[model samples]
Target: MRRIPILVTLLLVAACSQESERTYTVDELIADEALLSRTISDCRNNPGELRNTVNCHNAEAADGKLRLQNMRKALGG
Candidate 1:
């Protein structure tokens, strides 16, 4: 089999692709907040942990915001 042209494939993908935005519901946002709070609480309760809960929480919040923004743009709202 022949290798696909990277640039051509990428162009085709971009041209035919639709931007899909995930819509977050109020409940989902609330759940994210709760999860973030729990992450903080976890770190607070234990000063030492392997996983970075705070970072994870922050990333989740950031991703949630991005998703919301994308969905808003998609809906033209």
Candidate 2:
């Protein structure tokens, strides 16, 4: 009976250590895709915000764009 309690505790500990998978919906996926698409482009007209797209005039604004592209590539977008 004491051994049974130890085994149960071990099982619980193993289960708790397991990792869970994360799933995202299609809308979420598409929204992310759009954001990524925008990042790959350079907005010639606008020199202010990165706006998810690349901007030569606003190189400083490209931080999010570069980040978004890297993130999309990592996420398999």
Per-model tally of clashing residue pairs:
0, 0
**Runs in model 1 with CA error above 4 Å?**
1-52
CA lDDT, every model vs. true structure: 0.60, 0.52
**Cα deviation of 12, candidate 1, in Å:** 56
As a whole number from 0 to 100, the lDDT of residue 27 in candidate 1 is 47
| Top of the candidates by TM-score | 1
TM-score of 1: 0.34
Q: What is the lDDT of residue 30 in candidate 1?
A: 51
* Worst lDDT 10-window in candidate 1: 50-59
Superposed by TM-score, candidate 2 places the C-alpha of residue 64 at a distance from the truth, in angstroms, of 23
Predicted candidate 2 versus true structure: per-residue lDDT over 1-77, tens digit per residue: 89999999999999999695233333343456554344335343443654443233233334456667789999999
Cα displacement (angstroms), candidate 1, residue 46, comes to 18
Tens-place lDDT digits, model 1, residues 1-77:
24568778888999999985344444454557665555445555765661454454454565567679889999999
